[model samples]
Target: MKRINLSDKVITALKSDIASGKLKKGTKIPSEPELMERYEVGRSTIREAIKTLAMSGILKVQQGSGTFVASKIKSETLAQRLRRADFEEINAVRSLLEIEIVRLACLNRTDKDISAMQDHLIQRKKAIETDQQQKCTDADIAFHVSIAKASKNKVLVDLYQNFTSVIRDFFTKRKEENMTYFARSHKWHEELALAIINRNQESAVQLIKTLLNNNY
Candidate 1:
């Protein structure tokens, strides 16, 4: 198997995102040179990266109009493809990003942000106690998102939102196999909430990492 180059790491993200409609079908991505610059990789790596999607039939090369996506709407979305991603790989990236996000959020969160998070925590608690697992799950997401939003950085919020969808789906399936997961999640989230509220950045980041790594 050919290995992916570290510098052009964006190749996979771009390909999957284009197929997922995050980049939008029919939308022309930046040219080979632009991608190479962004990824800080050589020309050959960029070409090889583009070749992956080309081979997958998701990208169509038109001589004048440039590469266009497969016109079918369903095919443009990569949710099905995401389902096939290696969980170990996904979790590794998730861990790296979320830890820092929580750290930043702790430093930036305002009093109002704390209030919003508290409200989400309340909703989360009520949902679980009332046996509304689906609602509880959603509330759990809301709580984490509120914290990310409190970071006062749009990029973190956006990336968190995108990746968390996949993470949420993972937990949802895990729930089907093990119902008790929610209770432990509740306990951990409580600690997370308190850590963020206290502006204890290290504590918040640590708890978040612990909770995330527990899945494995």
Candidate 2:
């Protein structure tokens, strides 16, 4: 078995402490040196572990003061929880939401909504051609958000917004890691957009599913 990284091990220990109430909410965590000695890890590992906890809202760092348990520990928002979720879990939830979004958008989308998606699609293509990875990711997400808005369900739209924020990190990380799972597919995107524009619910749902499962 692959050995767990020191930072990850420290994170696991900290999380366990919190869960067991050994580290209560609003209580300060042990200082860096204390943590390093306790876990037998170096300063860098301790800092990295703390950074991960901070990002996940499990811990809060007060500059020049110390790290403390967040006031609202383990009660992470949906977006926050999703941010910490594995890619498979995030993708599964996204696929479920987007399938409904495509179907509803096909039934309820206005011409303006179609135009918005088209504009974002154009932007995405441009970003891809120029090899602007971040821009491409932004435009692609914008296009999906436009589709969710077209569904005209406020709850679904809000959920999609939160989901996008969580997934944006996935896109960025994949790009950095040289993974093609989330790469842009202009052709499929255009086809899906056209299906929504034409009010073809069946086609739109099929296209969206195909696009998501294509893994490229």
Cα RMSD to native, each candidate? 7.4, 8.8
Tens-place lDDT digits, model 2, residues 5-110: 9889999899878977889999999999999899998898899999989999999999999999994435447787778888798788889999999999999999
lDDT for each residue of candidate 1 in 1-216, tens digit (9 for 90 to 100): 234654237556676666467777777767878877877777777767667666777667777876666543355333454567798877887787688778888889899988988888898888777778787778878888898898888987877787767877886777764336666677788888789878898888889988887771
Maximum-lDDT candidate: 2
The per-residue C-alpha lDDT of model 2 at residue 167 equals: 67
Worst 10 residues of 1 by lDDT: 71-80
> Per-prediction TM-score, please?
0.64, 0.64
Give lDDT per model, in order: 0.75, 0.85
The pairs that clash in candidate 2 are none
State the number of backbone clashes in model 1: 0
lDDT score of model 1?
0.75
**Cα displacement (Å) at residue 60, model 2:** 19
